[model samples]
Target: MTPDQATPLLDRVNLPSDLKGFSDTELRQIADELRHETISTVAETGGHLGAGLGVVELTVALHAVFNTPRDRLIWDVSHQCYPHKILTGRRPRAKTLRKGGGLSGFTKRSESPYDPFGAAHSSTSISAALGFAVARDLGASPEHGLGDVIAVIGDGAISAGMAYEGLNNAGHLKKRMIVILNDNEMSIAPPTGAMSSYLSRLYAGAPFQEFKAAAKGAVSLLPEPFQEGARRAKELVKSVTVGGTLFEELGFSYIGPIDGHDMEQLLNVLRTVKARADGPVLIHAITRKGKGYAPAEQAKDKGHATAKFDPATGEQKKAPSNAPSYTRVFADYLIREAEADPLITAVTAAMPSGTGLNLFAERFPDRTFDVGIAEQHGVTFCAGMAAGGLKPFCALYSTFLQRGYDQVVHDVAIQRLPVRFAIDRAGLVGADGPTHAGSFDIAFLANLPDFVVMAAADEAELAHMVATAASIDDRPSAFRFPRGEGVGVEMPERGTPLEIGKGRIVREGSRVAILSFGARLSECLRAAENLAARGITPTIADARFAKPLDQNLIRDLATNHEALITIEEGAVGGFGSHVAQFLSDEGLLDTGLKFRSMVFPDTFIDHDSPASMYAAAAMNAPDIEAKVLKVLDIASLAAERRA
Candidate 1:
């Protein structure tokens, strides 16, 4: 049967309030419908599918039992919020998920009153929820006056250092709050580290009555009959395991290993928790990623993220790209470098596939280290490896690398360790929006002393930069590349290391010179072509290194050309800022050279197609052509504007 027919009970419910009057049997039907609806919607729109499906029953139970909007429920990472969105008055707009001007794939505070806090990154919900709980007690007035705050964090997210910090603080404060650990036994990749093993042991035994009591958290708080089971479970945990559980030691009422997908159990548990619970409580609800849909359940990653696909067959409708992605290019090149050098090791903060380190892992398993969701630990660990006379490539997304800034400074730069950082997804990534954008890495990393930073213009440039980063052994170094397909440049058999601080001129012209950093090199050429149509031939140079400045090349362009423009796919304080600083210091601006620096605007750009996003940033080819024309004083009486 089709999803629409299966969702008869769901058809009547436009909001969470609609589920209030329904019986337990009817509520179960609504949950089933919600699952099918979530699957169908994701198949059409193409986004985070499995996460939402996994939480369908849990979402229904929460919204049905507890008062949301007033209660303030926060989903960690929020990729699982699709079902929550559907039941919370966003069902009509659900089909537009992740498209331009559509509902966000993750939760956003600005989007709805239901979403009290905004989140896209992992493991932030517990802290935010605790803040709301405190604010509620202090009589803080919000859109919806803060009631009971609930943070539903995934098992993978809970492994992060921030989550433990939140748990520690929440337990110490003893503020009434709820933290639901959605243990699906999988993050984007399979679960890792000690936390995963600990969670597994929580339900491994036949002591359900005792386990239930220990898991229920705060035995004293539960109604009279439930206390016997709770006390025994607490004791059972204390007897064989670490004293009174790690969570109990933190002063929280620990409950569960409960079946998250079971509708009756979810309803009973949520209702009881809402009624009872005096201090901070943790509900451990064991779930399966991609719970209902057979295709998603069977596939790897449980169909974590997908393109628009057929709901019937679960076949994604994606067009084949002509060029390899920068991620793949980085992986292939890193593998080649590792083959030659045994000291080359890799580390990732729980993102092996996302950062292309999985390929490196397959070739050299012992050398690879997936350090769970702890970026700070990963950075320092890599620093230690470097200090021990090993070449460690710490591969992490540019946005995620911000978490390890302190380690980057103290452990790597301060000590002058040769730790190579492979920063992926640099620049304005489409769809995932500003929260995941890699706009600040260039600005943040380039300013540090004893650091070498490079931005790749294309796939070929990426390979060269990787080789260059590998060759740099005395200091910390990083290279960044954007998401999605490369510019179809020819693949080198193997990369040759580039000069330390040099840049090459791409096209030689006398009137004006266009200097670009990163993938904006293509846009610079396009701008140059447009200028040529108006009898203006411009010189183009690639600013390979953001740090070293390539002072000779900058001086040559400034000395020879009447006008100079620097462009980069980064924020204000990045490549352009450095170039402008050098020019100002050297009195290059006083030479009456028409100088302009193009960077992303001071405001955050929203989610859209990559081409559209660049247009919003005013860093596209047309924007570049316009900048040159305005600087050259040719825009005033435009001599037939050329494309």
Candidate 2:
């Protein structure tokens, strides 16, 4: 079953338990085939291709040498788990990766027994592996084997503070675990900081080659009595020779910067380390991202994620859309704002293209800042810029913005710095699923004191929100918008800052009032039209600010209309919760006023189209119409009983 053997061993393997029977040579052949399969699958699916390809040999070597389901192999971020998934009974599902109702892009515990822990967020693998290790020690008896725990993390993930915290704890506890540092000198963007430089030196030195040569030479001359002593001497000699001083200081026995793509090298090193290592160990493997695909290898971003592409030429097909995306709209607006206002600055946490800040960066290079995957730093950096009298727009995805919540509360909100947070992907992101969905930002940002939160109903409103954020120089403010294209409404040539708490009436009607929040306004309007045909005319209002609640308009709507329905594209404790609280506080509920909040449900929503997800959550047109009917029934019953 060696990687070179043409037996299709990979196709036969349905589980990690299946690999237990294969010889080391056979395992090597499977690794090669696995790499081929991973490359082909990613070409079709268009996902985190490079990271997975780089770890194919390492993944195969790990499963072959270790009992996976029992041993617990945790991958950081799980972007590199395609090969791991292929080897662990999920090869057939690989083609459907990231699609609706298909295989997950990242590792998931529920998806397979071999995936003991799930991960989509970065810098969590080491801590998760350590937890498993500690649990195994406490749960297992002396007779039962408490299997090995391994965490394969990237060099980029190490830059996060959580990884260091895990490493520090593991070192102090002297846990029996292995931490594989897969150094490819990239993480979406190029690696940064002093740590990245140190790793570069280690890779350049090729310390593994020198250490192996010295150990073989010494072992050849050792007598029988001194053989045990000689082996210990060899480990000491190797440890010192490899410049593992940093890891050794942290209480980990560090091993090689071995070639990660080399199947034999990876297997041999992994086997040697697995058998001989005591306490915590760090095995550094150097790999090239997009190893097999030359086009991806040469691309600036390594073809990190693409649309459906040609496997032969690696050329991505253009997706047809009726209107420009909200991201592009924001990017164009920001550039225009920067052109007029010299104080305007842009910042992103390693996602220039995703947040649409790349255009701003190109147009105004000095004004743009990419702080790597360090969201906390990016927030504070923006705060600092604000303090210096610069209007800094911190462009970040809503889910990733969660990482900087504390900073938002402490640095920006508390001090009342005017840092404009342009929250992109602020609702149910299509394919990225729960970990990437921007469902909680509304609630989180609204709760923070001195923070003004706004949600855009359309691209035109988004332009206005941007202008509003820029004009407000006295306090911290944020505006959130969805992932895809805006509704085909004509945008204003220049934006005018709207009053903070004021909302506008889109359509005036009599029986029921629908107070819409954010991009969900369009759906509310559609529902209103549907209700109109049924002789139930509804009032539609776009409540721009989620925080302020438009108290005047809401109270008027509650008093005048038969029923009030609030709608937003966020989770339970967001806009809906705030409206519920407001109604309760205002004593409107005591008067037996009918009310219902339409929002994303309590459970985590999966990867699907925006329309499908809204329908699933009962936030679509039909669902809204049904809710209106129910409310009207309640009102009718109350009126009849009163009469």
Candidate 3:
């Protein structure tokens, strides 16, 4: 297929099985077309554009070679699955990417049969692939047949300990699995650590020839009687000389620092490895993050994520009268605080730009640390900093923080270390979907002893929360804020620390009380306004702290109002669950007080706009209003027989 023909060919291929009929040359043409589609789609939807662009050729090569659906393909972090999605039956819906009821932004098993294993968190693909490989082996035998298991991971993802753990296990088992290391030298930001350095050395031609020569020399050195012994000895020497080479030691037949973008090289290498690989194989392919687009390639963070832009100019379309994003606001405040206090040190898990710590890093370069995808290390590292008398701000995404939960509980909370967690993306992240949603952090962190969890109602509150976290020195504290621009509110020059375990009434009313937490406060306010129009004044309170529940305020609200509701931008175990637990403990539930909790439904919400997702989850104004009216018996009374 030619370029024009390739477009129509791709348009017709909505499933991987459909591509089976196409020739390899035709498939390559389809890849080019897919890249074009992905770039155009992302230009409209505005997501992880560069990564997807980088993986287009790889995606085509993998699907063409492997029998997908039968052969499990797990994409680590899954930010680069746009091409895969396009090839696997979601092509028509590409334009609706990240919108409500549209295709997912990440690999989703429910989205397509070809997406055997889903992932959003980094470094999980290899482990997941190993699990599927094990399952397939267990189901099959030497007489039976088993399908291939491929894990397409990134170089940045390999920085995480979990990927190493998977690699170690896969190597130890000698599983017939393939791990494609997509090395772009980035993970939202430039990767760090000894592993990253090692990979960099491999990229720089440290010992490839030397190791091969040594192995050949060792084989020649063996006596006739001790040939087997010499073979084992050679393996041991090769492992050692590689500077504690973990992958080879673990037993993986490692191959290539090959060019990922070079189609011919990638295909030949992949085919060769697939044909002769008995044990596990790790293919290290180096490619640019934003391979095709010059603007994205030239971007500081490789256009990790973006707003909708023009395809011709690669310029983001400006919004009408845009307010400061929550991230920008946080970044600005962090910088201001760092400037005021020299002891204020900021840390992020390879997300300086994402967590709004880029400004802080810029202003206080000496104090900023990008720990790379190691969230567990980032948390404990921050704890160590705090113990050493430095104020450490551990900024991380709420979803990514899940990776460091144990560390947060064990290292920080257990020790009562004053490590301030600046948790960004604390709610349903638009486009990124459930895996990236900041749903469980509140519930997970709030439950821990010696931990203070606060969720900002808006950007102004986020500033105050940051100050509060900085001010609190007795125990570990975290402040979570949602993604996207702040609701245009008056700015505060300096953040004032609020009294702990306290909440404020935003609007005083009777009959019904709406307890709003995090970014859902605006929705609650809107709901309150709607209720007021119906002659039902609803009390609105911003319960800032998810942990250390404002018992006094909650009890008062329950006592005063005939009906009570709790609203939050999280799943079941978050603010609503805490409120239920509190009410149950206080014997408030038995008082015949009508109550309802408005939280994210117990399901994995797909990629969409934040507003649309909230609305779908019934956490929006109209839904909240409807629920509040129902709880107040207003809806029921309106339906009753007239006297």
Candidate 4:
């Protein structure tokens, strides 16, 4: 059931403006209902549960204190925006979250006016809010008429250099803005690096008891009755391990290290700040990642994200897997290689479990590094390791690696470092949407010199590539694998590295040849089956290497077959474009060979099931078959003959 159905108080809140007359007690009741609703919705739809739960009270407080839409409110990462969505006229569609044509998992500018800024990546909110603040002063976005721009950033987000950069610039500009540091002490993984420790030092003492004890002069700033209890809080804050003076030095009015869950305290503090804030102010509100819901609070990732689940027990309802996931395969193969080589080390940008580096970390703790939300740093760090005579596997998601492209070019590629880039989620990832899609990596990386790019056609191919990457210690190399389960091929006990710049002929036929890259080999086979049934058997070859385009195999296919089709699960200018350029340079296209390159449609595809997404991009089995038939002019020739 929705929050409005459960609580009458929330039923009245059709918009943020509706929260205008809400009393502190009423707002608290609304928060409780919002938490339940978030839990209920996630139990059905399954998304970022813990983050939304943690920010329920904060969401209520922000809407109550500030004028949203008109006054910009941006969520860092926006993974914690479910509650905000529910409050802002999206409650009815909450059950359809992350599904095709449903509400986005993260805030979207097109989805609503309330979501002034969209975000799926972390450490971007502060910068975006600062821009909005500046824009308001300059009267740029007159349609929104922005005032009091707010960025509710998480503790983990502040660890990034971008956050600090934004903070520094905002401080210098002296804009009237608010930065709510939602210090939940947890990101997707437990936070890493110096900032997490510094935040821990900000609220070291037992605040309540200290405030209760020091009730006189220190507590005078708070409301009269709360003085006794709040005095101890002030004393506890005063006795901080490190001062908020660092923020003051940045020219921000530092406040809190306060209890984020407490509605009364949240209302009091936010109301006070709203009334008096002249320049950029930072409110550090301490919170639990999974607050209110017991099952979520007890979860391993603090219920960061989930599949549809039973609300009471928090038991996830997931489909049974036929084979091991590509992630597991990559991890196991890497571990196997690392066991043989002492020089091998692994690195990730704060995604240990997500990147499957957690397994490597467990086996070789000394060799694994989780460089917190800092992709640029992680890449350069790997470069340094490679320079120091270490085989550093810089494991990162394809999207996150984009943030480190500069470093990849400057530190790794240019220097010709033997850094192995393990790019995960290398295609259209479902649920998380276009923001997280790995569409550009193939095109971006393949263009660089001294870089060997490979895409695994199946799980077995992935293992082989891992071994291949381990063996290649001359220059930079990367191998990409998709997000979910592999194609259930018989895996070898130990991977034997394949010859570089080579591809394997899966099925040989005469009429038309389909050259496949990455995991689309299965679909190519399926297309072959369809064509075979129609009395036209097609040849299929898996071009494992994208950069060192299997020239011999590509040349053979073009020469033998009347029609040739190249398919990859990436944007244009990737495998297909490279192949086209090769054929042109070699004068192969001068022959009467029908050539077609089927890549992802030249656009950002939205969130949908992987199969459906591929279909939309016209790279599925049927699409492949259609491309072959059209290129061969089978339908036209047959129809003319029949007539």
In terms of lDDT, the poorest run of 10 residues in model 1 is: 634-643
Q: What lDDT does each candidate get? A: 0.88, 0.82, 0.81, 0.88
User: For candidate 1, lDDT tens digit of each residue in 1-643?
Assistant: 2645557788888888888989999999998888889989998889899999999999999999888788889999999999999999999999988878999999999899889899998999999999988888888876566578999999999999999999999999999999999999998988799998988776776556345545445677666887787677666656466212788888787776678988988887788888888889888898899998988999878989898898888999999999999999999999999999999999999889998988999999999999999999999999999999999999999999999999999999999999999999999898888888899999998899869999999999999998999999999999999999999889898888999879999999877899988999999898889778878888999989998789999999999998989988888898888888999999999999878888888988888878888989988888888887877888652434434
Candidate 3: clashing pairs of residues: 14-89
lDDT of 2: 0.82
Clash count list over all predictions? 9, 7, 1, 5
Q: All candidates' TM-scores?
A: 0.97, 0.90, 0.89, 0.94
lDDT of 3 by residue, 1-643 (tens): 1123238668768777777788777777887788888888888888888898888889888877777777788899998988888888777788888777887788887778778777878899888888888888788533324878899999889888899899888988888999998988887888888877887766565545434323422232223554466466557665444422556677776665667877776676667666666768777777888888888899988888888998877889868755789999888888877778888999998888887777787778899999889999899999999999999999899999989988988899989999999889988887788888888888888888878889999889988988888889999999999888889999899888888889999999998899988888998888778667778889999999888889999999998888889988887888888898889999888898888888888898777877778777877777877787677667663333111
Residue 195 shift from truth in candidate 3, angstroms? 1.8
Error of 1 at 420 (Å): 0.7
lDDT of 2 by residue, 21-42 (tens): 8887888788777777877777
| TM-score of model number 2 | 0.90
Identify the leading candidate in terms of TM-score: 1
For model 1, the stretches where C-alpha displacement exceeds 4 angstroms are: 1-6, 206-217, 232-238, 242-244, 636-643
RMSD of each: 1.9, 4.8, 4.7, 3.4
Tell me the deviation in Å of residue 19 in model 2: 3.4
Worst 10 residues of 2 by lDDT: 213-222
Model 4 lDDT tens row, 280-317 = 88888889988987888898789999999888778899
